[model samples]
Target: MRLNQPRIKPLSPEGLTPEQAEILAPLGGGGVIPAGPVLNIFRTMAHAPKALKAFLTWGNYILSRKNDLPPREREIVILRTGFLCKSGYEWTQHVEIGLRCGLTQDEIVMLKTGPDAGWSPADAALIRAADELNADYFISDATWAALLTYFSEKQAMDVVFTAGQYTQVSMMLNSFGVQLDSGQTLDPDLRKA
Candidate 1:
C-alpha cells in the first residue's frame, strides 16, 4: 500500500527461468509453501536466483524451531517489526502464521499498541525489542536488560536477527510494491501508511 504500483513486476509461474526454477524447487517441498498460489515475494525474488537462494537459507533458520525463540514469541517480533516498517504484505502474511503459532486475535491486535499494551512482561519485552530496534537500530540497555530476564542469549540473538530480517523484508516488499495475495485483507493501519 505504500506505493501505488510495483517498481518491479513480480514474475508469473510461466516466466521463471530454469535457474530460478532450480533454486525455487525446494520451496514446493516445504509444507510451509501454499499449494494453490505462489506468493509475490517468491515470484519477485526469483528474479535474482543467487540472492533468493541465500535469503532462503537464513529465512529457513528464522522460521524453523532452531531459532531458539518459541513460535509465539517469534511471531511477536515478526508482527511488530512488520507493523513498524509499514509493510502490508509482511504484516498480512504473518497474521496467518501468527494465528497458527498460537497468537490470539486479540493479542495480535494488541501488538499495534506496542510494548505498553498490558501484555505479560515477557511479551512486552519482545514488542519493546522490536520497537527499539526499529526506532534506534539498536536496543537500549533497559530493553536489553528486560529481555535478558526472560530470554536466553540465543533467544536474544534470535530477536535481533528476526527484527533485522523482517525490517529488510519490509523494505523490499514496500519498494517492490508487492501486493497482497488473494484472500489477504490489508490492515487498516498499513493501508494508511
Candidate 2:
C-alpha cells in the first residue's frame, strides 16, 4: 500500500506534511504529525475535505482530554490497540508516550500482550476491556463490572472514549500504511517482542 507521499521518506518523521504540522500544533507541543490525517482518509470517502477536517478536530478533543486515568493506563490501552491493528506508526509513537506515562522498558514491552503482562487485577481488567472493545465493539459484563470497582461513572466513560478514539487511530494507521519515518523504525527488540 502506498503511503501519502511522493518522495523516498526519511525515517524518524515518515511523511509529516506542513498541514499535519499545523494541525498537530497543540498536541504534546508537536513532535510527529498527529494521527488525524490517517484517520481523515476514511472520513474523506463520504464527505468534503472540510467536513472531514472538522471530524478529526473533534476526535482530537476526545484524545486531549485528561481525565482521572493516569497517562500510563491510558497509554496501555493505546499501545495494545495499535498492536492489535498492526499500526506500526501508532505503536511506535505511543512507545514514547507510554514511557512518559511511567511505563518502563520492560513494562512497555509487555504491553503488546497486556493481559499476560501480569498487571494488577485492576490494570489487567482494563486491558481486557480494551481487547474486548476492540475485537467486539462492546465490553463484556465481567470487564465492565471490574471497571466499576476502579472507575466512577465519568471516569469509566473517559476510559471508553480513550480506547475508542485510539482504536480509530489504529485503524487509520493500518488503512493508510502510515509507517515509521525513513531513518526511523520501531525498536528492533520491540518489533520481535
Candidate 3:
C-alpha cells in the first residue's frame, strides 16, 4: 500500500519463534501455528508478540457485539477511516469485512466519496464522525449532535473508538508497508506514484 515492499518484513512461517507462533496461533487455526497462511497484517504484527496479543484482545472487543455500534455501523466507521487514511491494505481487507457486515457494494464505493454521498442521516453522521476524527482528531459540536440523534451514548462512544482503532491500524499498515494479501488488488485511488 504505502510502500512497495515491507519496511519490516513479516516473519516467515517456517522460521517463527515460539512467541511468534503463539501470537499467530489464534489468528489462523487452533494450533500453536496456523494450518494455512496467516493474513499479512497478523504476520507483520507478530514481530511484537506481546503487543500483537494485546492488540488482538482489544480488536476482538471492537469487533464483538459489546461495542454498542452494530456490525454494519462499525464497518462504516472502519471503512471511512481506512479511506481517509488512504490505507490501501486496510481498505482492501475491510471492504470484504464491511460487505459481510451488510454494507452493499454501492455503500462501499460511497464511503470513498465522503459523508455527502447520499447516505442516510445516521450513516452520514458516522462518516462525518470518522472524517472529523481523521482530520481534526475531534468531532465538531454539530456532528456530535447529529451522532447523538441516531446513536445511544455508548454507540456514539463506539463510533469514536472504531475510528481511533482503525486510524492506528491504517498508520501501521502504511508505515510498515503491509501489502494486500494474495489475489487482492490495490484500490486505484490509493496507488502511489
Candidate 2's error at 103, in angstroms?
1.1
Model 2 CA deviation exceeding 4 Å by range: 1-52, 187-193
Q: Report, for every candidate in turn, its global Cα lDDT versus the true structure.
A: 0.89, 0.63, 0.89
Q: For candidate 3, lDDT tens digit of each residue in 31-114?
A: 222356788889999999998989988888888888999999999999999988989998988888888789999999999999
Task: Show pairs that collide, candidate 2.
Answer: 10-182, 11-181, 11-182, 11-183, 11-184, 12-184, 14-181
lDDT of 2 by residue, 1-193 (tens): 2244313222223444555544433432343243433322332221233444675675555556445676677777878777776666677777877887788898777777668678887778778888998889898888888888987767677678878888777665555455564345665533423
Candidate 3 residue pairs in backbone clash: none
Worst 10 residues of 2 by lDDT: 38-47
Give RMSD (Å) of candidate 3 vs. truth. 2.6
Error of 2 at 102 (Å): 1.0
Tell me how many residue pairs clash in candidate 1: 0
- Relative to the true structure, candidate 1 reaches a TM of 0.95
Model 3 TM-score (2 dp): 0.95
